[model samples]
Target: MKYKTKSRHIFILMSLLLITSLVAACGGPATPAPQAEPAKMEEPAQTEESTQTEEPARVEESAQTEEATTEETTETASATDSTPDSGSVELPEVDPLAVTGDIISAGSSTVFPLSERMAERFQDEGYGGNITIDSIGSGAGFERFCVAGESDISNASRPIKDSEVESCQSIGREPVEFRVGTDALAIAVSQENDFVESVTLEELAMIFSTAETWADVNPDWPAEPIQRFIPGTDSGTFDYFVEEVFDKDEEPILSAGNLQLSEDDNVLVRGIQGSPYAIGFFGYAYYNENQDTLTVLSIEGVAPTGESAEDGSYPLARPLFIYSTAGIIAEKPQVGAFINFYLTYVNEEVIDVGYFPASEDTLSVAEASLLAALK
Candidate 1:
């Protein structure tokens, strides 16, 4: 009985020990490692300290940006100072004979005779350097001046087109125009033809395009087939004729039968001289050269002559031009000097070249333009 009571006491003691261990596991305080770290997050932030540390770097970046901006502004102003505007340019009167350097020019077959004469006079006056002039038409000349950037000067029978100006601007060249002379375009027929002396604009158009026979143009005339000769499409004269006479529609004239087109005005003169039925138009200089072989026609009772061209009496009269930029003049002093000489002497030689001298006001304006460009 003593041993059994001792055994019951030992079992009850074991049961109490196990119950105490379970209560401790279920309800005792945790170590709280995660919660302790969360409170530490509320302490002094290192980000604020890092931001303060980067303050100097931000200031430095701003300073660098401002410096770059200032540099760019300075460079822009310096560039502007280097290139002067044409309106503000001023050129001093200088001697052309003392100038040197080769001159390269292209454009305008009509202007060729005038330029050639000027070049000869320039050489006679003592310019030893070669002056090369090309008669490659105005459009081709602009291409050489603007697109190719090859020629120092471009001669044009007509003013530069908007497209040509755009081309020059694209290549960083701004063309300046100088009116050099006036041209009287002459319509000529073979010397053998004496029946027709004058024609109206309508009759001229009909003769060149729609009229197949002389009777087609006029009932009183004979039924001879009409022959037409004209400048090539590349010629500025062609553009002018199409614009003025055909209303810029070239199809009627270009599509006509018995039509001959040539870039050389001399060829056109020859073509007209070949047959009495043939007729053609070209610069007055060409007509003047072949006057014996060809007959100059009276258009609407107006004849082409220097006085008629200058006085604006001739219907086919047009202005002639030569172009050079201010930059070109400054860079090539010889070109500038040559232009000065040409302008001073053009009026004297223009008649010899079969063109008219520009009016006094026109010459003055040209001189001012040149002076302004060179200033």
Candidate 2:
């Protein structure tokens, strides 16, 4: 009975030792190792996934910023190059004469300075071969221009008369009219003549006509004889003075052959400037050129100037004209170009040359009319 009891005790001790060893081996090999390996692997995977997501988002944001910047830069560049800041566009660079082809322009000697300046500028810009201009009396110019196929342009101090238009139409041509600027027909005397200050329209008529002496027009004036220099019958200036001041009536003194007549306003200026008692009338440009030697007389107590002329305060103000043939513009590219350039530069250029620019509304109407006629 003692030996059997001892064998059972030994078997029990062996079973307990085996169970403890198995538990330690299973726990060591599986529990702690699985937990450590899963944490290490999962941490790296999660970090990589987060890194990939953030990189793509950052790249997209950077691309969007770059695209927006590029678009803004492009828009700014386009705006700077296209629009004119001053509301007026710089004229496109073009050879004015070359664009027009061969050009022929003739007109009022009074309108000569502006035309000559334009022609000179055109030539300087390489248009010398394309343009030729002449300064003839306004009536003579119209007479030639009205003849069908005669001339490309006619410059005039006055608008085309109904009779002149009929003359053009009779020859199978129509004249398109353009107003370039305003003029003040100034009555000038020698700078030495201090007796005269101002005169009314009625007084001008009397002074130009039957009044042979200054004292005849005004009893308080000097007794010296008043010498007169008048433009010839073919001058538009003469016609304007006749119509505006004389009521188109024939001057008895002019009919009596007492008035000195000349086609050249320069000659008239010379005649007046040479004689202290002499008086003559011409366009403001001529008066401006001879301002040193001549004294401009106020009409109805109003001086002739750009402001006064524009406001109708100057009685002698008149509209200057450019008459173009419709047929010429159709057949000649130069004629169209010349007209366009003239209209484009006239506002500033006309004023630069001692003439008044037309109002903006008038210029707009003229440009629209010319463009439509060209079309």
For each candidate, the alpha-carbon lDDT, in order, equals: 0.78, 0.73
Q: Put down candidate 2 lDDT per residue, 26-130, tens digits, no spaces.
A: 867777566567545433212112223223244334334444333343344345436433333333323443342356666687787878777666666655333
Candidate 1, superposed: residue stretches over 4 Å from native: 1-94
TM-score of each: 0.75, 0.73
Worst 10 residues of 2 by lDDT: 45-54
Root-mean-square deviation of every model: 28.9, 36.8
Per residue, candidate 1 scores C-alpha lDDT tens digits across 1-375 of 999999999999999998998778764655556766864552231111222222434433433444433334334434554533443322344444555556778788889889989988888877765677877688888999999888888998999999999999999899988999998888899999878888888898898888899889988877899889998887788888888789999999998889999776777887888998898888888988887888998788998877788888778899999999997776666676778778878999998888888987777678777766655
Model 2 stretches astray by more than 4 angstroms: 1-94, 97-100, 256-258
Clashes of each: 1, 1
Q: Cα lDDT for residue 194, model 2? A: 84
Compared with the true structure, model 1 gives a TM-score of 0.75
lDDT of 2 at 310: 94
State in Å the error of residue 344, model 2.
0.4
Query: Ten residues in a row with the worst lDDT in model 1?
Result: 45-54
